[model samples]
Target: MTKPIRKAVFPVAGLGTRFLPATKAMPKEMLTVVDRPVIQHVVDEAKAAGIEHFIFVTGRNKGVIEDHFDNQYELEHTLADRGKTKELEALLRDLPGAGQTSFTRQQAPLGLGHAVWCAREIVGDEPFALLLPDMLHLGARPCLADMRAAYDRHGGNLVAVYEVPQDQTHQYGIVGIEPERDGAYPITAMIEKPKAGTAPSNLAISGRYILQPRIFDLLAQQERGTGGEIQLTDAMIQLSREQAFFATRFDGQIHDCGSKIGFLMANVAYALAREELAGPFRAELEAMLAKG
Candidate 1:
């Protein structure tokens, strides 16, 4: 029987240097997209995908993230006392259960692989999902849920992939696939940021992953790649050679909230997609465009 992916590791230890002054005081994951923080959106997606344990690999000054997931007693009491049923219900809806959440500090800015390794004990020896809080995937079906369905059928390591422009292949980890089966391709090899014109395919690996525990072993000895940091893609490349690895092409739009323009676009897109905000937001946006 295939081991169920019940836990998810979120690597949010990055010092969001790109966002500068704002990120200096607060983590990029805590920045708001629409009304909810970016990390909350990722956790909600994982919950929708049936993830039971939420393990966050955070860094220094990231206490706000923990507090965000915890119950706000004072605020909840205030809302309840005022008879604001809807507000109270909304606040309580997304908070994870007491024991369902875990937080570990990465201690050093090593790399994604190192950050994931920080959650090794909590993740144990089971297949787990890894999600990057900086990437928000919006779709009719949750991105991780679709990846989980693929993982169930294939019974292997699955990486959520999406097509990127040929010129942009160098910006992501690219994969070479065998044949397309059920919207997924058996990943033959993984190339981390391939050089221009040398990429095998444009199927770029996104932030979502359903990785087996064996990967943890590989990451432990992985050598730094690219920017002198342990690259998870490098270890994954080794795992693909010895185990089953597939690339599931996700049907969604991924907004890279790590960058300024991308963060702005995420706010605009999510706002425009909301039922209550769409009409007004679009009108105001069009009015601004007309003025320009």
Candidate 2:
């Protein structure tokens, strides 16, 4: 019998060089979209998909991420004293319960595969979901939840993928497919950042993944691919040869918040999606655009 995927691994060890000075003192995962921090959005997505254990692969100076999930006793007490029940409730609504979250350190700037491997002890031998906080997806259903449904049906490795332009395939991990069934298809091959015009297909991997435990074994032996970093894609491709690898084309707009433009766009997109901010935010954005 296939074990249910109850745990999730979040590789958050990277230094956010792209964001520069802001990230110099703060973890990139702490950056906000709309109102909540980026990591909070990711945790909310995992929680919505019924993930029981949250394993965060952290690094030096990432203590804030840990504190974010912990109870803020002083802040909560102050809110209670001030009779700010609603604010306090909102703050506590999404924080993970004690013992539900586990933090492990990734001592070096190895790569995605290495970061994932760092959480092996916490993840144990169960299939787990992996979420990259930088890639924020906005849709009716959470991206991980959509992938979870696909995992339930297929019971193998699953990755959330979407169609990109043929020319843009080089920018992402591209997957070759067999055919489609229920918005998912059998992934024949995965090519990370394939050279221009050499890609098998334009379907690119988004940041969500539900992987089998055997992947940890493959990642253990993974070599550096593409850039000098040990890519998770390289390990996944090897796992695909021995297991059923599938990709689900999720319904959502993906915001690549790892880049400056993408981060700004995500903030705008999320703000415009909010009920309280949409009206005024849209008007101001239009006004700014009109002047530009």
Candidate 3:
């Protein structure tokens, strides 16, 4: 039987240096696009994919993320007494259902692998999703939701893949693949940020992943790999050799909100997607572009 993905690990421990000054005081995951913080979008996606438990791997200054999901009884009561049910309901969506959310500290700036390893105990022995909050995926169906569907059918580890320029593949975890018809492929290998022109394929693994719990064991034995950090790709490469590893090219716009320019672009893209802000936002952006 295919194990259901009931838990999701969100690695939000990194000090987002790209948005610094602003990010200096606040956790990067708490920064908002439109009205939702980067982490909130990821949580919403996991929730939509039937994730019953939310595990946030956090660090210092990430209290706001926890606070964002906790109850504000006084505020709720005030909104209720004023007949602001719509606003109250909207606010409630951010609050994790009781017993559904948990947080743990990474306590170090290791890397993605170590960050994910921090949540191993909570994840136990079930399949789980890993979301990189810095990567925002916009779609009618959230990226995690799409991966969940793929997991339901394929029943092994799955990662979201998107085609990028060969030169740009060096910036991401490039996957070596064996075709499985249409756009799906069995990931033969995964390399972290290979030099340009040396990538096995143009397909790069984005930050979204549906992983099996056994991966924790692999991660535990993994040494400092690429980039002098415990790279998740190393553990995943080992995990792939023992079981299935697949990638699906999702139909969505993936934004690298980790970079300054990309973060600004995300704000503009999201602002343009909002009905109330679209016209004015587009006009201002167009005028700004025209001036440039």
Candidate 4:
């Protein structure tokens, strides 16, 4: 039997200093995009891609995240008593069910590599996905689903790539590929945030990935690379030689939800997508735009 790609890791350990006072009392992932928190969208995407187990690598002051996924007895009772079944169902929905989700604390700000390594025990020896909760992506199909299709066919590492401006290559992991098949490339190497005019390719690694379990061993060394933190890209590069990696262009419009402006943009974009709120939201946005 084929091993199930049932587990996923969400790295939510960042302090979210970029969001300042708003995040001071709450986790950044809890920030709402329209009516749902940013992490909820990420969780929904994972569920769409056939993921059954949710593993969160969290840090301090992240209890709210845990509470959000758990059953709220008082809230459910109020909804049931008031005959608010529709709203209650909507609110209570989306959890992965009892015993299907778990959390592990990182306990330090080591970086993405360390964050992924923290979930090592839960992940075990199965191939799984890593989703960045801070990136809000919208597509006809979920971004994780896009990568999973490629992963099942190619059977190794897959990183979602998108075309970024030449000057912005220093902001992401750029892929160097040897075209292997349709819509997939055999990764020759990866340059993590290369200097301007030195990037291997403009196809930058966005926020989604399906990685092999072998990467856990490379991350075990835990040597600090670029940015003076244990970079996940570094470990990925080391594992690329032993197997193969692919860069698949994800069909989505990604908004960096970690930044202030990006957060506002995501809210506006998502609100416009809602039927009940779209009319008012767009009218307000148009008035704001007209005034500006």
Find the candidate with the highest TM-score and give its number: 1
Error of 2 at 12 (Å): 0.7
The C-alpha RMSD in Å for every predicted model, in order, reads: 0.9, 1.1, 1.6, 1.4
Model 3, residue 17: distance off in Å is 2.2
Each candidate's lDDT (Cα)?
A: 0.92, 0.90, 0.88, 0.89
Model 2: residues >4 Å from true position, as ranges?
none
Instruction: Write model 1 residue lDDT over 108-194, tens digit each, in one string.
Output: 888998998889999998999999999999988999998899888888899988899999999999999999898678987789899
lDDT of 1: 0.92
Please provide, for model 4 over 39-114, each residue's C-alpha lDDT reduced to its tens digit, 9 standing for 90 to 100: 9999999999999999999999999999999988898999999999998989877767999899999999999999
Candidate rank order under lDDT: 1, 2, 4, 3
lDDT of 2 by residue, 1-292 (tens): 6789999999898899999999999999999998999999999999999999999999999999999999999999999999999999999998888799999999988889989988888888889999998999988899888888878888889999888988888898999998887757999889989999999998899999999888889888887765677789889988898999999987688999899999999999899889999999999989999999
Best by lDDT: 1
lDDT of 4: 0.89
* Superposed Cα deviation of residue 188, candidate 1 (Å): 1.7
| Alpha-carbon TM-score of each model against the true structure | 0.98, 0.97, 0.95, 0.96
Clash count for candidate 2 is 0
Order the numbered candidates by TM-score, best leading: 1, 2, 4, 3
